[model samples]
Target: MSAMLHPISRRLFLSGAAALGGVVMLHPFAARASANQAHLRLMETTDLHVHVFPYDYYADRPNDTMGLARTAAIIDGIRAEAGNSMLIDNGDFLQGNPMGDYIAYQRGMKDGDMHPIISAMNTLGYECSTLGNHEFNYGLDFMFKVLAGANFPFVCANLTKGSLAANARDDALFIKPYVILDKTITDGAGQDHPIRVGLIGFVPPQIMNWDARHLTGKAMTRDIVKAAEAWVPQMREEGADIVIALSHSGVGPAQYEENLENASLHLAGVDGIDAIVTGHSHLDFPGPKFEGMEGVDNAKGTIGGKPAVMGGFWGSHLGLIDLMLERDGKNWRVSASTSEARPIFERVDRKAKPLVESKAEVEDAARDMHEATLAYVRTAVGKTAAPLHSYFALVADDPSVQIVSQAQTWYIADMLSETEHKDLPVLSAAAPFKAGGRGGPDYYTDVPAGDIAIKNVADLYLYPNTVQAVLVTGAQVKDWLEMSAGIFNQVEPGKADQTLINTEFPSYNFDVIDGVTYRIDLAQPPKYDPKGNLINEGANRIVALEFDGKPIDPEQKFVVASNNYRAGGGGNFPDIGPDKVIFQAPDTNRDVIVRFIVEQGTINPAADANWSFAPVDGATVLFETGPKAKDFIADVKGVAIEAAGDGADGFAQYRITL
Candidate 1:
């Protein structure tokens, strides 16, 4: 509804907050269109993942950067600024944090139950929504039950039931592949015209692999681009004036590969698709994040020459695509367009500053359930003798990661006691989930020493992945460690003041396998790239690897405990997939951790110094973490680190001498 959009910020106003007053009268389009021209504003929220309140249940604190209740203000303000607008959700609303877990695991959903997220969404004027991979985490029945409470209809073209029919359209799909909404458009001249708007939805095809346990034999999926090619043309043939795709995928190269997860770039090339609403990568479009991607115009927010937008995840931003439509004979064509992700808050001085307040109506809708979720997460489960934090998880063997490893090892050891691999050594693979990457500087976990609660446990393990154990040879374990060591960059011998951690490498993929000792030599090149691709074949960053006071034999087998995501090929790590998995427990990893903690009553989760960095001989490097890391710098073992200064992007910088 903004009349003008700033080039750099993509904000509606260059000066004051005039649009905050809400709902303005019909104004002239920014392009100054003729009487036949109309301006349509499309607003979207994606990957919300059950965060309806501006609160972090894990931290038990109010979070300004998250929550749809806060984003609802931005939505209301922008809709008031635009004369014509339609709101839609890009999916992933079913699961994410403790509130979702509390509802799915603790509070059961009855036939007519209303989920907190759905209740909050119903208050907002959403025309349609799509399915995200996380929606299947609770199984299809629970997902459909939650959707039944939504006020708007749901559409997903790619996800299907049973087996694939040779003709994609003829397949018995889980939901209607697409829907056409007949809407009235208001032109610049204040004239009204009837228009047919077609909206289609698509989820990543990888869901069949990622959620194989829930989807196998029950559901199937088609290639996103192929599905778009088959359905968009039919949508046009069905008297659709304009087609908009609600793609719950990320922006990748314009590579037309079948069953590719991030296929939004190629999906844009499909004929008859006018615009796209993209998400699932948790990034913002018209932002610097995707500026270098092939066929993506970050400034103009176009993918493969088609206008697109991906709102930041966790309700941080609202995706907006403003299209100036021109009448092309009997049909309307987009003459000019501008897209942006408007944030509800900004990071100033490493702290969250609210840009928009929570909407009263949306907050009221989710008020009761929000309190219930908080109560559920705050229940006392156990206690810890020492603090648990992941500030130095990437740099050293950390207690936060150690506790998860201990829990996993304990649970898996018992589960396999009666199995064929009972005699094999049990090792647990754990990673630092909240090591402060895209979640900002405050993302690190900090659970104080004392009584531990469900929220603290949830904070330690962010995802809802199930526990799994895989059997692999010693050589495969070394390869796995090499892949994990990719998180660090290769350093020149005796080079001072060099950077250490590779920011591109996600911390979750940096798995630390317990029950073994190893050394990561930064002097050698990494064997694997950040995307888990083999780069240096002969590189041996994981040197001096040993087990039980002896060098590990390459042929000897061991059972490693991990989550379903890693065991089911989520990160593309070598020699780690479903075939290698020997046992799959029905319990979630978070639940396993909780059970371990309860059994211990009060336990110490101290790091065992199982891993360390090989001395680089007077080499010094820079490391970054949350500012709060300064308080526990002395707790880091076997490394010489000192306060360096502030780093870019609001992170605290430190110098490490190896």
Candidate 2:
């Protein structure tokens, strides 16, 4: 058997392995003592994202890091160890990988058809679930059709069918706001007592902006913390012995704000809310990932002084929250609690050691759909003359990003041919989706030269976001690039191996705009912060910005092709929103790439070196990427990267001199 270190586990040592004896493994609940007290174990699988089988449909290979099948093994083991247990999902299960795309686009769910992911969850006997932002990607009608397959109840307090009323209780909810499970818990004395477990769910209210066209008149969302404040009290009033908030949001910022996307920390502070299961940022809690944040007790797995856990995305971890409940005069109250996100695999010397094997029940439930997904992605659309990889995407203009930009430019130019903006110069913005980051050291686009299939295209462009072209002035374009430059750390002229990439900046936000030329001055401070706020307005990192052959005019208007996420203000970019969008297409960006490849017959997707770093005399910086990157080192343009050494975990180190 081959044991490979997945890119996702490459960073596990820093966040999980070392802290957990080289494995983030946990046994079942083991802390109840008295006859009046009972241990109720809660298991959570968040952001499954249709990864039911132990397979990566994009790579068309087995992956140990993700899959509900593997997670079920942990669930069964945990359930056996605890006297009382319940399993619920924290949303983001409907769609993610190629299997989801196959079901939604090709298989077409009928009224009674069982979605593969739902089938697996049903096999595992999931008690309840909630919604994530991606649930609305295929439209409301399609989402409902797929939801019909779920055997468990779905709850969401914030998502509503229409406009809000004066009071949240009067609003027309899209689904049941909450569900109370009436179960019996066995105490240490073997006494059986009735218990009511209340579970309420919340999705990011920003879904209104991300999926606006699909939800305009039919659906709306309320603020997350605000909704929880209104509903937790109601749940307690309805005789909920314990209240759990299934928040499909991230843990961030302790303070409350209206429509804050990552509000789980504040949501935990709501009175009557006993525990929480968080997701949406695809990160783990109770690990080093959430450590340093205020009001977050990472060592104790508590946020807002209440037990909480965030299972890593794509079925990588199982969130466990064990509450020690004591009978309070015929009712139950949580006395003590502990939480942790136990990973399915751990990293040791750059190799993966799977903690749990795939349970056959879940694998069997999703087997048929998995095979169909394989067939769907195997069909070739076109051929590529050169290999497409994203190993150095964060440090250079990459072909993987270039191909996407080319395809978007082609699609948007044709769309504008018959419009009033036909004369405007069309520019396309794209970023590397599969660049090695949190996904792991093995996570990079590596499509060999030759036939380009649906899988390859999917690898290059991961999201199902629709294409949108925004009309912005040249000055705004400069600002966009300046924002992208924020991903790099400032390098001093005489520095040696100073880290080049900012570990916190996501690769998807590092937009490289095609149809323009620019020089990034690394010596200058970044103009925009990671969240796209202009912190240093006078910092001019983007220098010699040009379009066509002349210096770009601040007043000149141009059509910039991008995805709905950017046009809809998903990334918080300054001066980039729906108001600047001149064209929005129903077609997805992935489909656009397929069509463009088909039209070209054999596409050559080599980087053109349109962008480069402005030399800061003798400055050198280092970064870590996939080990496979060494094979394509000679192909990267403009930057001369040499092997520095092996980095921590499984990543390879490379240095670039300016």
Candidate 3:
């Protein structure tokens, strides 16, 4: 592999890893190769989120489906067959797992300290990278300290910083807006030639809104398309042959929205771009998952007439874009392109088998930091009287979310005590982040009864969203619950053995509000869509809502403690927006839960059973949860989840009777 690679090689460290050999191109663009031609393979790993090992730090177990170490092997596997290759990360490498938290909070990133993920990436030999929204989770100072340890250049055309206030100038960029690489590569005909490859990067402008604490008055963002239009032309004027966009954004609507979070599709429409490496959505492009989408040719891997690819998140897949280039008057133009994601493990008959082994060198690079992270996460934070689990989070009142709700409410109560809203009732809303869904059955959280560690807190709450409190009227609260009810499929009163959960509604969107009691009537349609738009204005799934034994008043205002995402219009719930946000806590929800556990010492991990489905005669619905849920069936308070059978992917099928 090293012999075939150029000096600017992609997989120098991958010594003996075997490529899967089968290259399935979901979308193939036709290429007319000429005598003077070269093949450049662009490899991308997006949303790594600090996953360097095939290990789940939250679960404290070795997982088969994640890690950059494993993806490094695949990079070795594929780069051996290509003439020239360049490795790039599309962003979100900083914060996700317990390792990230440990590095940020436990072991501070000082002047000389190296982040484990960056160390692993440096070992893998990444050419360039970009920033994701989560990069700012711990604050800018920490983010920059971590970035300083990276061996590769990090670029983002949209994210800019200046001594001056917010502006739209590309010159104000904190990092280089774009990097031009001068490289010599071997062509398909075994001839050496020089090529100037322009690499420009972009991040979602929503980072300002998402990470307001870190970005306010310090950094500003421009629209992705605007950044691309401004910078791609400049890169060309600097004598670049081809421009590749390291778009740390997701593929979404074709039509451009100024400062849109997911703007990769529209960014590709910008002239002067050859190809795009997209991320931030945690989905694979050119896969059937994106089939039949507007302005996207999934089969051809082209968005807006340009080759594009989005590698799956957490280093699950390495995005491969093979471009066929022909020399045209001392410049190279792409004649054809093909893109696909190569997974570390392949699933056959719903069972995953390892396709590539973890590169020992990469693993060795991260071993020291990995051990420290494990020790940090394993430190006992508190104790749980009952099991801190989420296997039954969707079907019943979950102890996992309950503890988070308790923590948020506890934190917000003190924050509001001196304020005018102190007299008003406080409600906390939390969601089950690990409930079985597209992540499959093993995705559910199951923290055993005993000492609870910081790792357990991560399992209880997966996101890094900070605590936020919003003031809303009773009517708005009802509407919020109605929006949450969209997680369920409308069930006929007399139906039997019907699927009840709406697979489209993410488990994280199913907010369980504490302090107020309500019942979800499954027979009625959801008042709001999953995105929180009022679809059926008159529909009300929240049959009965009461506070302190009294029915909720539409005019009365109450403060609901929740995450920043929810208060910042994430769920699009009615009367919930940045304007309505009354309090913004600096601590992340995960930290709040940790603090709550510490303060309590020995905490009761029990849901109060404040919410449940309204009983309907002769109604039976089927749902699936992690197989571990069977052990705690008797502990569920409100819902009757009778074990029906063993479900696919190691799930336990349950029949809910009403």
Best TM-score among the predictions, by candidate number: 3
Deviating ranges (above 4 Å) for candidate 2: 1-31, 381-399, 407-451, 458-513, 518-544, 553-658
Model 3 agreement with the true structure over 234-269: per-residue lDDT tens digits: 899999899999998878777677888889888888
How much lDDT does each candidate structure score? 0.86, 0.85, 0.83
Total backbone clashes of candidate 2, pairs 3 or more residues apart or in separate chains: 5
Ranking by TM-score: 3, 1, 2
Off by over 4 Å in 1: 1-31, 381-399, 406-451, 458-515, 519-544, 547-550, 553-658
lDDT of 2 by residue, 398-449 (tens): 8999999999999898877867999999999999988888889999998999
Cα TM-score per model: 0.72, 0.71, 0.74
Model 3 Cα displacement at 530 (Å)?
16
Writing each residue's lDDT as its tens digit, candidate 1 over 1-658 gives 2222111133433211333643344334644866989888899999998889888787688999999988887776666667578889999988877788788878879999998899998988688999988899889999999999988889999888888889888878999999888777867777777788899999988676556668888999999988988899999998898899999998875757788778998989899999999998778997997868789888888988988999988899999998989877779888878898999888999999998778777888878888888887788768998889999999988999999999999988887775588899999999999998888899998998898998788679988678899999999999999999999988988789998989899999999999999999999999999888999999999988999989999999999999999998878899899899888664578877877887899979988889999999879999889999998888888778899999879999999888
How big is the positional error of residue 540 in model 2, measured in Å on the Cα after superposition? 11
Ranking by lDDT: 1, 2, 3
- Candidate 2 lDDT at 489 equals 94
lDDT of 3: 0.83
